[model samples]
Each structure stands twice: as C-alpha cells, then as structure tokens.
Target chain A: MRNVFGKIINTKMLYEYVSLQRLLFLLSLCLSCLYALAGFTIVATLNYIGEDIYGYLFLIFGICFLLTGISSIKINKKKSVRILIFSLILFLIVFVSTAYPSSVGLQDYGLSASLTYNMIFSIGLIIFGLIGALLSLGALFNFKPLGNQYGAYFLLVVCMLIILYPLVIIIGQVTINGAPGITWEFLTSDVRGLGESGGILPAIVGTLLLMFIMFVIAVPLGIGAAIYLEEYAGGHFMVRVIKMAVSILRGVPSIVFGLFALAFFVPIFGISFLTGGLVLSFYALPMIIRSSAEALKSIPQGLREGSLALGATKWQTIRRVVLPPSLPGIITGVVLGIGEAAGETAPLLFVSTLIIKMPPNLLGMVASLPTHLYTLFGMRGGLGDEVEVAARMQNAWSTALILLTIILILNVVALVIREKFRKEF
Target chain B: MKKKLSKEHIIQGIFLLIASFSIFIIFFIFFFLFKEAIPAFIEVGGDIFSTDFSNELGLGGAIRGSLIVTGGALLIAYPLGIGGGIFLSEVASVWIRRILKPIIEVLAGIPSVVYGFIGAIILVPFLTDSFRMISGFSLLAGGLIIGVMTLPIIISISDDSLKSVPREIKEASLALGATPWQTIKKVTFPAASSGIFAGATLGVGKALGETMAVLMVVSAITRAPDSWFDIFESGPVLTSLIAGHWGEAYGLKVNVLFAAGVFLFIIVSVMSIISEIMQYRIEKKFKGG
Candidate 1:
C-alpha cells in the first residue's frame, strides 16, 4: 500500500492521482473553514442594512453557520485533522463577525436581539469547540476504531441518562423541600392562596384518586384487548386495523389524548377525577394492550395446545394455562402504565385545572406531579418566584423520582416474570 | 354453526373488542387535533405554514431548526445506540451485559422534564463556556440533550432486533470461518438491519415528539435560516411551539400553533406507520414458528 502510494505520488500518471486525492481532502477542509463565512455575511449585512435590521437575521445566520460547521465534522472522521479544521472554521466565523463589527465599529453589547445574537453566536462557537477538542484528541493519537466507538457509545448512554438528571434534581429539590413541608394540614388543606398560606393535602388526595380511577378505568379494558388479540381473534381485517391503531396510539401525544378524552368523554361523565381517569385510560390502554399482547404472543403455543388437547375450554386454557404464565407481563404493563399516568401533564391540562383550595369532594378539582410543576412554573411571576419556582421544580423532581422508582420496581418485576416464562426458539 | 359463539370465541371477541377500542381512541385524538387545528388554521389567516410572529416568515426557521437538532442528535445517537446494542447482543461478557441492560431499561423511564433540567443545568452552561460561545441555550444543547433522550429508544429496540438474529445464522457464519465481529458485521447486521432501522425511526420520532426538554433548552426564535450553519442555533420545535406560545397566542395565533402541531402529528403518524410495516417485514423475515 505504501509502495503504491509512493509510486502513485512520484510517477507521472499516478502523480495526478495522488494530487487529486490530496486536492479532494484539501477541498473538504477548506469547505469546513469557509463555513463561518456565512456568519460574516450576516454580521456585515446587519452593519450594511443598519443596526436596526431587526428580523432576527444575526441569530438565524449564526445558526446556519454552526450547522454547516457541524455537517463539516463528518467530512473527516479520522480524528485530529477534523478538530483542527473545525477550530479553524469556528475561528473564521468569530473572527469574521468580530472584524465586521470592528471594521464597521458596531458594538452595542449584544442588546440588538435581546442577547439572542450573542446566544446564537456562542452556540456556533461551542459546536466548533466540541468538534475541535474531540477531533484534536482523535488527531493526536490514532484512536482505535472500536475503542473510540466504545467511548462514543459510553458518552451517548451517559448523556442520555444525564438528560433526565434535570428532572431528578428537581425531584431531589422538591422532596427535600416539599416532602418535609407535607404536614397533616398540608396534606388535608386546599390551595386557599399562594405563598406559605396553603397546604397540598387536596392535591395529594386528588392525585391519588386520579391514579386509582385511571387504573380502574384502563387496566381491565387494556387486558381484554390484549387477550382478544392474542387468543380469540384471527387475522381478520378488523383485528389488523385495531392492532395498527394501537401502534399509532403509542405515538399520539399524551396531551392530544387528554384533549380527545376531554372533548369526547369528560362532558358525558362530568368534570371529575373520573374525567382524568378516562383520559388517562385512553392513554394507558394502548400500552396495556400492546404489552399484554406481546406477552400473550410470547407464551409457548405448546402449552395452549396441551391445554386444548386435555379438553380445557379456551377461556379456561387462557385463564388457567396462559394467564398464569403471562401474569408477570400483565403486571409489568400495569406498573409501567402507572408510571406513565403519574408523569402525565398535557392530557390532564384541560381535564384538570389548578384549584387554589382542594376539591370539596371526589368530583372536585385535582392536581398531579405534572400539574404541580406547571402550577409552580406558571404562577405568573408571583412573589419569591425564583425560590418558589426552584422549590416547586424540586417538588416536581421528587415526584418524578418517586414515579420513576415505582416504574423501575415494576419493570424489575416484569423482567423477573419474563425470565420465569422464558421462551426458547 | 351455533348462534352463540363458543366460550373461547365469545371471550376472545370481548377481549378483542376491548383491545380494539384503543385504536378508536387514537383515531379520536387525531380527529380532535385536526378539528381544533383546521378551524384555527382558517382562523389564523389560512396559511398552511406561517411562523410570522413580528412578521418573521413561514415556520421555515422552526422546520429547519427541528431538522438540524433532531438530525444532529441522531448523528450522535444512531451509531452509539446500534453499536452499543450490537455489543450488548453479541460481545460483552454476561456480567457486563447483565449490568448494562438494566441501566438501559431504567434510562427509558426517565421523564423528558428530567432530561430538560439536566441539559439546562449541566449541559447548557458547560457546553457554552467550554466552547467559549455566547449563551448556554442553543441547538447544540438541545441536540446533545435529545441525543441522550433518544438513546434508550434506539438501544432497546436495536437490542431486541439484534437478539432476534437467528442462532443458526450465527453458527453458519462461524462454520464459514468468520470471527464473531465479522459474523456480527457480515451476517447479523444485515439480518437485523430492519429492526435497527425501525429503532432509528422510533428514536427520531421520540426526539421530534419531545417538548419539555427542547422547550427548556432550545432558542424559541421565528425567522428564516440565513445560512446552512443554523444547525447549531437553538430554535423552536413543533411541539414546543404549542407550549411556548399558547399563553400569549389566542385566536388565529393559537390555530397556527395547531397547524405546526399538525405537521408534528403527521410526521409521527407517518413514521409509526412506516415502522410498523418494517416491523411486520422483520417478523416475516423470521417466518413461521
């Protein structure tokens, strides 16, 4: 390979080949470098058009430049070279933008777009900075492919979990702050008013009630769907359509489902936790059906045949033979459903609104973890709002943590059940 | 045939009816969304795509922003997810795999709000200063955060698909003198590609659907892209529009938000449909028991 490259470089015909390869590589590098030129144009255009060209052009162009730079990172995945190139590109943007400002003497402390320009310009720099650092490291040493792949993969998962860290922090913050504040008065009291005067007793009770009602509403129906799909229904048009619909439901935003439920079911039932439960039921039922169907499908066919051969009725076979084995998955589905139900906010938004004081009865107003977060966050700039928001955000986090733990525990149970009913090919 | 169905048939039909209702419910959601959105779209000057807040332009900026953010995040996520999934399904020692699997599972349930908070508190500032950039909030923060959010979706689905790769195929590859890695590369990936692709679609779908994290982190600007590099800039995503602007926006403005929402709904619905088809193909590939 070296001899080939060497000969290709030195020889007449092959010299062109070598130069062409080098040219392509150089062109790619240059393209990355020139990417920041867009930022320059935006800045220049801003200066040329006058400082009051307030169409958010600075921010828009800055973003475009950053994207070009990011796309340029893939130009060379060989490591160090990419980093150097990315840095050069980023420097070009910053240099060009700053130079345009200097050449035109345009300095206004980034108040042009309420600091949007500064934020966008900085984001562009960060993109380049990350690429530069990683690419530089990648350049300095010949990073082994698998080793790098492993490292990248590690970062991806850790990053993903850490993405949830904000919620967890809020949870921790809330638990430490709000959990302690949960006196009997707090528990029983209504949100009579804001700021240190009211308790969350009604809210808690309402939340628990919603959970209970949703479970009651969703679980049975969901299981029935699962059972019907697994054991009874043939591959009929209706069955297939139903299955597809369920899959789509799995995609529908929980908020939309809440809206639909509010529109379709709430009026018929009234503005109670029942409405919340009904909405959540629509949301949770699909999951239950899907998961339980999966569990049912997983049960060995031989067991069903065995039961049938022994004169067991289909119901008896499913209940006595299949149901026992599939219980774990069913339970897992239920637990997962609860976890989802507890975390949901959008669907509950219209179905349930914040009541300052708790509901007078079961049919009265309600609030859950999501609603609580929204309440705390959306209190229209109330007093001590910063600390108050922080405290409430913390409560939201703690509630989320509690919700997550419940789901995790349930998943553990499900896995154990899946293992117990382990099917072999 | 008896007029009354058999006990098994009767019970099953009931179950099926119950199971089937979920699809109807989902349909109802689409109906409601469209109903509100359509009237609202008309109410909001009837423009199919307009983000003209302060006379900005068609949600062109948002579309571009979401694509960049989601795309960049996917660029980071897909390989890591599939590769890690490959390792989980094939290479890792049992103990390591045992430990890692549970983490992926747990990671899946961590809420979007948590993910947002993390990105805002930790990732946003670290990225901003470390890069010596302008502000903590940008497309980069949203992408990185979303990349994390989408990982479990990709990993779990990819893992499931990769594991579904037949043992006989593996044995055949070994018999043909291929090493484990080579077998995984040459044989398993091809077979599992459908599942892996489906997982990728799911990941993208989830990233697109994610609101709170994106809302907390991404810049909520409404302007046209002046250059291709806007991928680094934080801007509104479709769902984020609903949450961010719903308060101040009423009348046609709210309807415009719904129109943007319609785009999101279509994207997700179409994605699920395609993936469902792909999943069916994968199952068909496995053939009869």
Candidate 2:
C-alpha cells in the first residue's frame, strides 16, 4: 500500500509539471497564431481586397484555431499535437494549391490575375503556421518537464532579435538604395539645380568646417569644466548646483538650443558658422563634461596621492599623471561629441543655410550634410518634376549612408580606444 | 612656493569660470526664451489658450498634441526598454552584453534626423497601408519614431541603475529558494526602482522635446484632436510648431514660437530636476546614507 501511495504521488508530480509546460507551450502557440493571422490579413488586404476587409476573415479564422487548440490541450490527449500539425499542414497544402497559377480552380474563384498575390499571401501563412506547429511539436515530443531555464533563454533571444532586426533592416535598405549613387564625382562636385544634379561637395566641406570650429571651441571648455568638477570642487553645494545645471542643459531640447541661438547668436553673428558652432558647442558641452568627469573619477586616488607624495604639484600631477591615463576617455568623449554635432540639423537650421556654393569664410552661410539631406527630403512635391524628386531622393539616401558610415566609424573607434585603455587601470 | 601657489590659484579660478559657463548658458537660455516669449504671452493674453485652429499662435492644440505624443511614446518605450535593461543586467552573458552594449550605443548615436528620414520613407507608408488611414502622418507615427529613438536612453540608463543594485541582495533571494525571475522581481527591481524612474523621466523629457522627427513625419495641423484619444489624427506638437514656423515666422509669430519653446523648456526642466533628485536619492540609499 505504501509503495502504491509513492507511485501515485510521483504520477501527480509528473502530471503537474506536464501541465505547466503545456500552458507555456499553448501561450507561445497562441501568440504565433495571432501573429500569423495578422500577417496574413495584412498581406491579403493590402494586395487584393484593398484594406477594407482586413481583420474580419482573419479574426474568424484565428478564433476558430484558438478554440480548437485550447480544447485539444484541455483533453490531455497525446494525439492533440499530431492533430494540430496535421491541420496546419493540410491548410498549407490547400492554401498553396488554391493560390497556385496552374490550379484548375483558379478560374472558378476569379483570382487568375492575382496568382503572384495569392502566392505572397500563402507564404505569410506558411511561415507563421510552421513556427507555431514546430513549437507545439517540440512541447509534445518532450516528456521531461521544461523549466524556466529554457524560458529565460527563449525570452533573451526574442528580445535581442526584436532590438536588432530593425537596425539590420534600416542599414540594409539604406545601403542597397544608396550605394549606386556614391560615385567619386557625386562626392566632389557642388549640388546644383536644388539637389537634382551635381554633387555634395559644398555640404561635405561645410560639415567638416563646422565640426572643426565646434571642436576648437567646445573641447577646451568642456575639459576644463570637467577638471574643475572632478578635482577642485569637492562636494560643495555649488558643485551640486553646477551638476544640476549640466543635467538641465542635457535635458533641454536640441530645438530650443536652435531657437536660443537664433534669438541670441544669429543677431550678433548674423547666421554664420560661428553661430552654428557656438550653439553646437552648448549641445556638446554636457556630454563632454559628463564623460570626461567619469573618466577622471575612475583614475585611482592612490596615483594622485603617490604623485603628491613625490613632491609633484597638483597641476603637475594632473597634467603628467592623471591626464595621460584619462586621455583616451577624453578623446572618446570628444569623438562622440563630434559625431553628435555632425548629425545635428535643427541647431544649424536657422543659424546656417543650404548653400549650393560653398561659403567664402566662417562668417558666411554654409551648407551641411544634415541640412542638405533635410533639404533634399523636403524637395518632394516642391520640385513639381517627378524625375527631379527622384534624383533628390537618391542623393539624400547616399548622403544618409555616408553620414551613418562616418558616425559608425567614430563609435567603433571610440569603443576600441576605451577597450585599449580600460585594461590599464 | 609663493609663485607656484599663485599660479595654481589662477588656474583654479579660470577652470571654475569655465565650469560655470554651462550654468551661465542655462540662465541665458531662460532669459532669451522668456524675453521673446513674454511679449507674445502678453499680446495673446487669454488667446494663447484659444482652441481656434485659425489662430496660428494658439498654444492649446500644440500643448495637447505634445502630451498625447509624449504619453504614447512613453507607453511604448517604458516596458520594452526596462525589460531590455533587466535582461541586459541580469540575464545576458558578459560576451552577449559586450556585443549588445555597443549596438545599443550605436542605436543611440544615430541622429534624430536619420530616424525622421526613415520614419518618413518607411514607417509612414507602412502605417497608412496597415491602418488604412487617409494620411500616414499622424500622432501614432510621431510617437512610434520617438519611442524607437528614446529606447537607447531608457535602456542605457536603466541598465546602469539595475547594475548598481547590490549583488548580495540578489544572492540572498536566490539562496532562499527563489528562482532568478523571482529574485529579480522581488529584490533587484525594487532596489533599482528609483533609478528606473529616473531613466523613465529622462525618456519622457526626450520624447517631449523631440522636434525634428515629429516635424518630419507628423502633419503640422494646428488644431485640437478630433477625439481626446485619437492618436491616428495629425496634430501640432509644441516642438514641431516651433520648428515648422521657425523658417517663415516673423515678429509676433516668432515670439509665439519662442513662447512654445519656453513652455517646452519649463516642462523639460521640471522633469530633469525630478530625475536628478531621483538619481541622487538612489545614490544616497546605495551608499547607506
């Protein structure tokens, strides 16, 4: 009797574990079915039914599938998985056979001209159905109870894919569309006829010049401020206030900075590169200070004390000892700031202009890569000519590709520098 | 010795002044925005809040639009970003974190204009087809693009906060026969709540102030939404209004734009202050002060 009781308890435990796994399996199955139904409806309506009949047919089909799956799971029968898989396969076969061009039934449905459209629809349905079927099959085949360990891995992979997929698509699309337009001549000549012809030479030069001016102005001030905050200020209330101010600056919208520059700098400087650069400097300052301060804070206190003990002055220690070690970090911050300033459009919009011809000097209006792209994008209906709009779009994509490439390179280089110097401490 | 001391004092003084420059600029921004914005406020008086669409300088519609877009963006960004953050700090292996960290940083580094461009070219058409909206440029499009743009900020900051949670508490929870998820839910998340709040506030501030992406995708319709909850309709946000009008704005119109900027500045500043205080409190609590 005791042996029989032990066997019953063991069976009960096994039953509970199986039930839990079934629940999780059903959840993923439901999600996959919903996803498939949505995809199917989108493809069908967008391609054939003209978006008016969306969600009706698919909703009905999805509800039916959900009901069938739920009832099957509730029955605690081993053949439910086989039944689900069989139905999915049967549906796939029917979908393809009906959607195919050579099928004799096509004439009856009046979908002969939409052979390609039906094929696309079938593809979406097949993809989602296969995923759901496979996940369910895995759950069915496994007798041992699945644990949270596997669930954790599943969640991680899904989330990572969710984050990475969009990046991949954007980069892929930009490259495929833009690479043909990135010829040497396209990079060298000045834009003419409102970005319909010629190259982005002036925009490239102007972007470089603006970055140079911004660096010259922002780097010293940012570094000095970082130094004071890290070394001289201690934990004073004034220091706290300064930190708050920097956070506030960081939080201020880039557009407001543009407006402030328009209100303050443009009238004084008359909408020149100087005004643009000064505003960009304000934008870069908080990043520079925060990054440089973090770098300085990471330097060992023992090293500072060691230098002081050896009779080196505080300035000497900072310049010779602290600064050298923190140089990579500071440079990383500067590169990041440069990348940010280079990509900025709003701050430069009012303070700069879209000059097809290059500016004669810093005080004159200039073209920039971002502003040039903005101009090209905004050239849609205004150009009136379809060919001109197409050309402008091609140029805009190429410019975007170049801008993204430059920023990516800067980031990679910063990462490399940080890794190289990080091991030293 | 005297010469050395004098030189050091001078250097300190110069550095101090340089450090104070940011603070000076903050006040200067306030002064400039208000100097121009106040005149418009006084001129428009009660008309500033007018719901009339014909009133080009009305703040009511723009304010409501900003709230709707920002709120929608927060709704999308907070859960995904915080979940990603939790995964990064707790679940991801060191090698995976190394690969993923740079990706997140690079995503963050991508300019707002590029996001806008992508949104205009890709997201707008997709939304139009899928949702069957007459026009694709709507609050939903703006919110989505901003949400994507705000993800990196939320993830990076929240990850930092979650990483700051002491390991001992997590270990203790695990030792008490709790699962990893349970430990994270019960101990790590609560301990890191303030930091997460700070990150969320920063994300809200970002979405609130995002101009170019919204300006590029969202139609600049300066009117009240058809319904309070209708995110599918095109509307004018404050930042977009400032950006859209900045090109042709003159005299009173320009001041009104500045008034919009001033409003943005105030809202953003309050959020920033709150985030800063939250961060401070977190630090203090972690330090056992």
- Give me the TM-scores of chain B across the candidates: 0.91, 0.97
Best by lDDT: 2
Residue A199 of model 2, lDDT score: 89
Worst 10 residues of 1 chain A by lDDT: A104-113
For model 2, the superposed segments whose C-alpha errors exceed 4 Å read: A1-153
TM-score of predicted chain B, candidate 2: 0.97
- Taking the tens digit of each residue's C-alpha lDDT, what string does model 1 give over B67-167? 87888789877876776677677776788777777667666666565566556655676655443445667777888888877877787887899889889
Model 2 agreement with the true structure over A1-425: per-residue lDDT tens digits: 35533553689866675666567567656655565555655453344443223234334444444444555564345545554654465455445544444312223332211123333444545465545545554454343123333444455455555566557756787898889999998998878888988988888888888788878988999999999999888988979999999999999998999999988998899878888888888998899999999899989999999999999888889899999999999999989988887888888777666677754368888578888888888877676588888898999999888888888998999999988987876
Q: Candidate 2 clashing pairs?
A: none
Q: Estimate each model's TM-score.
A: 0.72, 0.85
* Model 1 complex DockQ against the native: 0.22
- Restricting to chain A, the TM-score for each candidate equals 0.63, 0.73
